[model samples]
Target: MNSKKRAWFVLGITIIINILCQEYFFTEQFINFNPGRHNILYSAPYFVIGGLLYLYRKEIHNWMNIIGGWMLLFCLVLNIGYFLLPISDLLGHSLFPLLIVFTAYHMYALGSDKKWLHNKIIDFLSGISMEIYLCHMVMFRVVERLHLENYISDSNLNYVVTSVLTICLAICFAYCVQRGLDKLLLKKIA
Candidate 1:
C-alpha cells in the first residue's frame, strides 16, 4: 500500500472510531462526568499527532521549536483564562486538542513530505490508537470499581491521579493488544 493512502486510512479509521465512541459511549458517559466545557477527550487527537510526529521526527523536528512554542503559548493563555475567568472546563480542555489536530493536519497532510511518513513507530501507533480509544472506558470502569477516587478528595488531586492512571493503563492495554494482534497476523502470513 502507498504511504499517502495508508495515512489516509489511519486518519479515516480514527475519525470513524471517534464518531462511534461519541455516539454510543461518550454521549452517555459525558452526562455522568461532565467535566464542564473543556472537552479533555479532544486531547486524544494530539496524542495521535504526537505519536506521528515522534515517528516522523526528521521532518517534524524542524518545526518542533516553532510549533512547540506556539502550542505552549496557546496552552498558557487557555490556562490563565480557565482559572482567572469563569471559563468552562470543556472549552479549556477542548481548545488544545483542536489546535493540535489542526496544526498536525496542516503540518503533515498538506506540507509534509510523503516519503518521510513511513517511519515504523508512527505507523504502528497510528494504527492502534483506535483500539486504545475504544478500550479506555474499560480501564476507567476499573478505576471506579477500585474506588480509587475515594482516596483523592481534593478535586485537583483527583483529576491528576485519574488522568495519570487513564493514560498509563490505556498505553499498557494498547501495547498488549497490538503485540498480540501483530503476532497473530504475522503467524498466519508466515
Candidate 2:
C-alpha cells in the first residue's frame, strides 16, 4: 500500500468523524465523541499538514522555495514571525495545533539552515516529546492531588518551585520510560 495515499485516507476518515461528531451523529449516552480525549478527530487536520510536508520532504526549499530569491528578507521575517507569534499564550494556547504545524516546518528549516540551532538536548527532547507530554500531565495531577500548590503561602516562589519540580521530574520519568520501551521493543527484537 502507498503510505502517502494511506495518510490521505486516514485524514479523510478523521475529518469525516469530526464532522459527524460536531453534527451530533448519535446521542451522548449512546456514543459521543465530542470534547473528549477519544475525539482526536479534529487533530486530523494537523496530521494532514504534516503528511503533505512528509510527501514533499525532498522538495522543501527556503522562502526561495516559495517567494523565490532576492526577496529573502521578506520571507525570513514572515517565517520567523509566524513561529514566534505562537509563543504568546493568548495565540499559542488558542492556535496551538496550527502553530504546531508551523513549528514542525520551522524546526526543519532552522535545523537545516543553522548549525548551533539543533542541539543534542533538542534532539533528545524531540525524540521523547510524546512521552514527556504524557508523563508531565500525570505528574501535574499528582501535585494537584497532594495540595502542593496550596502548601506555600508565598505565591510566586511556590508556583515557580512547583513548576520547576514538575518539569524536571517529568523529563526524568519520560526519559526512563522511553529507554525502557526502546530496550523492550528494539533491543530484544534485535
Candidate 3:
C-alpha cells in the first residue's frame, strides 16, 4: 500500500479501538474493577500516539520541535482555561490527550536542553513500559477483589493507594521480566 493509504489505515484502526474501549468501559466487569479500567485508560494515550507517531514519523520528526514548541504554549493556554473554568468538561478532558501528544512529540524530537528525558531511569521505564501496562491490570484487579476500597472508607484515599500500589507492583513485575530476558540473552551468548 502507498504510504498515505497505509497511514490512514493505521489511524482508522486506532479510532475503532478507541470506540470499542469506550463501550467496554460501560460493562459491569470494568465498572466493578475501576482500577483495571483506569490502568487501560492511562495506557491508551501512549498507544494512540505511538501508532500515529509511526505513521507520521518522518513528517513529525522533521517539524516536531516547532509543532511541539507551539503545543507547549498551547498547553499552557488550555491548562489555564481548564483551571479557571473548571465547570467546562470540554477543555479539561481535551487537555490530557493534547498534553500527551505534545509530550510524545517533544520527547521524540529531543532538544539539547532535554537531556534529562533521555536518561537511564526513563529509558529503563520506557523499555519495560509495555510489561508494566499488562501487569498493572492484573495487580489492580487483585486489589479490587480484596475489598481495599471498603476497608479504606475514603474514596480518594483508596484511589491514591490503589494507583500507587498497582504502579509499584507493575514496576516490580517489569523489572523481573527485564532480568529474566537479560539472563536468557547472557546464556545464549555463552
**Which prediction has the highest lDDT against the true structure?**
3
lDDT of 2 by residue, 1-190 (tens): 1477777787667656655655555447666444533344555556565655656565554532454333444445656776676556555343344535464554355325444546898788878878987788688666656676567878888778878887888899999999898889997788
Off by over 4 Å in 3: 1-4, 13-46, 67-70, 79-113
Counting clashing residue pairs in each candidate, in order, gives: 9, 0, 0
Q: Quick one: how many clashes does candidate 1 have? A: 9
What C-alpha lDDT values do all the predictions have?
Answer: 0.60, 0.63, 0.64
Give lDDT tens digits, candidate 3, residues 105-160: 44454432256767898888889988897787788777778788678999989989
Task: Write candidate 1's Cα lDDT for 1-190 as tens digits.
Answer: 1254565466556555554555666665556664422344444454455455455566655664446556445556655654676535655433444544455454543334345556786677667778788778777777657776678788888878877787779878998988998999999999
Q: Candidate 3: lDDT of 171?
A: 93
Whole-model lDDT, model 3: 0.64
Evaluate residue 131 in candidate 3 and report its C-alpha lDDT on the 0 to 100 scale.
89
Query: Arrange candidates by TM-score, highest first: which order?
Result: 3, 2, 1
TM-score of each: 0.47, 0.48, 0.62
- What's the distance in Å from true for residue 22, model 1? 16
